[model samples]
Target: MRPGADIQAFMGRLGYEFAQPELLIRALTHGSIATATRPDNQRLEFLGDRVLGLVMAEALFKADKAAQEGQLAPRYNTLVRGETCAAVARDIGLGDVLKLGRSEMMSGGRRKDALLADAMEAVLAAIYLDGGFSAAEQVILRLWATRLASIDDDPRDAKTALQEWAQAHGMQPPAYEQTARSGPDHAPVFHITVRLDDGSMADAKGAGTKRSIEQEAAQKLLSRLEGGQ
Candidate 1:
């Protein structure tokens, strides 16, 4: 069967066309909207995670021949992590085509990082199953070309980097506290503060998971410290 206009547009953004359009539909199907006959994307997500890891590992390995495992490992992690996948999904407007139940739709499922990431992986798996490894690799490489080119040597997440900085300066590990929370339960905004032992602190507000807000807060503090504030 042929895909609708929206799906075609999505494919245009993804730079891949599905031979079996049903696979793309299935990949966009979330558990909330899936029936027994029309399974969810969870299984595809599982497979896609491994496929993404392999592709990223190979890409990192080939990108820097002289780099050791220590250097490549972090870069691989940075690329295949859920946040990166979610960012890629957002770039392609994957959320706009997600098939969700009323509850999930009301709860803002499209904007949820975990949901977007899972769907992104499922889409990758669909591409793999529809075409072949080469096809999936090509899609991943194209989608992640910018990230692949500019990944940091350390590639540590902000929270980890902040803790290391504190340790290096003879201070205790940074602490995170959720100072405020508002909005509805399903879509809440969090205010987080990251404090160091030396009385340095930074606060940030984010709409999503508390962990993400903590990371933002840590990044803010890290940036300030690095700037000699």
Candidate 2:
């Protein structure tokens, strides 16, 4: 597709057309491909993080009238976490519009969760800057509707549950080893192994961070142990 057509399609997916199209362009620019004149999305990502957090917090508070602070915290984390943002980005095909360095593009950067998540946040910031917070809030609610509807009132993350389970079973805390790393430097994949003291273990790979990959492995192990797999 032509560049203008591609951006138009992306705007349609994001549900917001930037008044300053340059903001959208900057939001999709990766650091590896940025220059002095063409800045990356890092600053936009920072602003977007705050904007998203505020939107999510407000939404959660209004949605759960009876929820206490403790009750709301986990749901907040689940909603704003990088993994969830990456999923949202994928849902809107954000990767296809991203501007990556040659090396990054060659290494499948378009499918990398970290890059997609960051870009998604930058795009949110762009929307906020282009229109205002109200615009950003509307976009977030529409894009995150399914996730918002599916949250448990007080859900524990996999890492926390895994640690509790290990302690309960008299095993030392689970150990996570970085078993493998692949892909280009700009967008690497992590393979992590989570092992119990008794030698039972699980391993999983993810396109996000090492910590996220380890959490995924732990979740898999927990599911297997709980017979939910």
Candidate 3:
């Protein structure tokens, strides 16, 4: 069966035409709206998770041939994590084509990170099933090209790095405090401050999620400490 106009538009953004249109349809169908006839994307999500993992692992291995397993593992995790997948899904406007129930729609399901990430994986699974691993690899590589190129050599996030720095200095783990929160429930902004035992502190504000704001704060603090501030 042919996809609808909206799904076709999504396919244009996704950069792959589906031979089995039903697979794409299934991939986009969320559990909240699913029925016996129209199943959800959970199983495909499972398969796609593994597919994404393998692709990222191989890419990282080839990208840094001399890197040890410990180094490559974190890079692989950075690429295949849910946050990265959701970022890619947003790039292709996957949320616009998601089939959601009324409750989920009212709750801003389209903007949710987890939902988008799962659907992205499910869609990749559909691509793999429709055109095999080579086609799926081509699509994955194209979509992730920029991220793969710019991925940091140090895979540890700012928070982890900050804690490690403190440990090496014989200090306690840095503390993060949410100093403020604003905006509506669906799109809230967070203000986070990371403080060290030595009274050094850094603050950062961001929208999307509190954890991200905290990470930004931690990064700022880490940078300051590393810069001899």
Candidate 4:
């Protein structure tokens, strides 16, 4: 494939094309690249976070009219969340296009979920800037429609999954306690501890609702229990 061919293809899948290729480059640039050495994607990521959220909220609100805010919010969080973005980036080969510093490249920054998610957000910002909100909405809906569509009030809940997994194994359900919280009230980093009845425990950190954080902590503990190293 040519240099930006895959990116262009991804945009094609996204139903928008950038007027400026530099916007895409900036989106793919990591903070490890440095502002002095290379203007990184931080500003674009900031813009993207807002744009992505707006697009997602509108889609979710429109799709499930019977769903209340309490029910729809967490599902919305997971669809645009870091893990989902990282999965999409890997799926679309965005990780290979990432421009990282030597240290970051060596340290496996390309595979980092947080970075991938930020890059995805930056890409959304770039699309929005180069095109418009319509473009950004196109990117978001393309990436997130399936995730949003599959959500409901039944077996898909993270808390429910964690509980069922534990119960089936003849163990008590995982216990979650909010260990710490910081940042402004609007943006908090929730630290949650997930403890199994058998004394197994794992601490996971995430920036989102407590339900999301607890799900993360439980997922981590589940991984360790299932013998993931």
Candidate 5:
């Protein structure tokens, strides 16, 4: 699709036409394509991360009136975490509008989980700046509606759940190793493998920080174990 057409279609999906389309442009620009004059979306991603955290925190607080701080904490983390953000981005087709450098584009930057997640947050920040908090909140709540409704009140993160499972079964804790790193430094792809003492293992790939990759890998391994795979 044409870039402009893709952007307009993306705006329709987001349910908010940008008052300042430049903000949306900047949000869709990756660091690889950025120059001294043309800025990237990193700053917006930072702000958006905070915005997402606050919205999720308040949401969890209100949704679980009887939940203690400890109980609500994991749910909040699960909701605002990078993997979750990327999933939302995919659901909303945010990747199609992403502007990437030649190298990144050739290497599947649009499909990278980390880049998509960051762009998703940047888009949120752009909406916040273009409209206001209420507007951003509305978009986030709508986009994340299904996730919010099905969120566990006391969710255990994948890494923690794997560790607990290993301990319970008298196995060593799951070990994660970074198998690969690709794409540009600004939007790197991480490939990780998680292995249990019993030789069961699973591999997962994601974009973003190594820790997030490990968490995803652990989750995959856990799922395999539970499934008797």
Candidate 6:
């Protein structure tokens, strides 16, 4: 069933009053919703993509004083990547409020990565529209503060990247199991197990951000599998 009250409560929990409530509505509204209602989020998705890049670029610029093209490029790419944003958005309550089409709803569009990522970007654009640049900046920074802080630092983001790396190497890639995620939402530690395609497994503990730790864990797992340190 449609969870309008649940969505309202979710916004309440996020501590942001949606001045343009329709903006949030649009963010939560999917293509499925549009066929029955008005326009879908496609245009908003395009606009949001640009807006997200601009916001991340600005954040990167402000955060890294000595960042050059080489270092800044990866950070910028990672910050705006659909996978990363989808993970972050899912961590929030965005996944819960999706209003999907009946066909899409049955197909589980609500849990799909593409849908989740776009919703996050659309939500950012909505915030930008509602409260000018500064208001949007504040909200974006608040959400992306960790990514902003870690730009200049050379840290390992092992788990997901490692899988991608393995896949690039023509390997079937690895699987990660979240053994645990402790602490509050803002500060959480993850224990992820990396399992190779050959049925071999390696374990590692990562500190700092979840993505960072996962990468570090993957690196360690890769090294162990490859007979390194």
Q: What number of clashing residue pairs does each candidate have, in the order they appear?
A: 0, 0, 0, 0, 1, 6
What lDDT does model 4 reach?
0.78
Q: How accurate is candidate 2 locally (lDDT)?
A: 0.91
lDDT of 1: 0.94
Look at candidate 4 and give me any clashing residue pairs. Answer: none
Best by TM-score: 1
Q: Across residues 1-229, which tens digit of lDDT does each residue of candidate 5 receive?
A: 2337778899999999887888999999999999898899999999999998889898888987998988888888889988899999999898888989999988778877889999999999999999999999999999998999998865788899999999999998888888889987766889999998989888989776788789888888888888887
| Among all candidates shown, the one with the greatest lDDT | 1
Q: Is candidate 2 or candidate 6 better by lDDT?
A: 2
Worst 10 residues of 6 by lDDT: 151-160
Q: lDDT (CA) for every model shown? A: 0.94, 0.91, 0.91, 0.78, 0.90, 0.72
Off by over 4 Å in 6: 1-4, 151-229
The TM-scores, one per candidate, come to: 0.92, 0.86, 0.89, 0.68, 0.80, 0.66
**What local lDDT score does residue 211 receive in model 2, on the 0 to 100 scale?**
79
lDDT string, candidate 3, 154-204, tens digits: 878888899999899889999999889998766778989999889999999
lDDT of 6 by residue, 1-229 (tens): 2436887786765556677688778777888778655667776677778887888887787777788877777788878888777876876778778778878777666666788888888877777787777776777677777766665444335565567767876778787788987774434567877776666676656444545566666777767756754
lDDT (Cα, 0-100) at 212 in candidate 6: 54
TM-score, cand. 4 vs. native: 0.68
Could you tell which candidate, 1 or 2, scores higher by lDDT? 1
* lDDT accuracy of residue 210 in candidate 1: 84
Please, what are the lDDT tens digits per residue for candidate 1 over residues 106-166?
9899999999999999999999999999999999999999999999999999999999999
lDDT of 3: 0.91
- Rank candidates, TM-score, best first: 1, 3, 2, 5, 4, 6
Task: Choose 1 or 2, whichever is better by TM-score.
Answer: 1
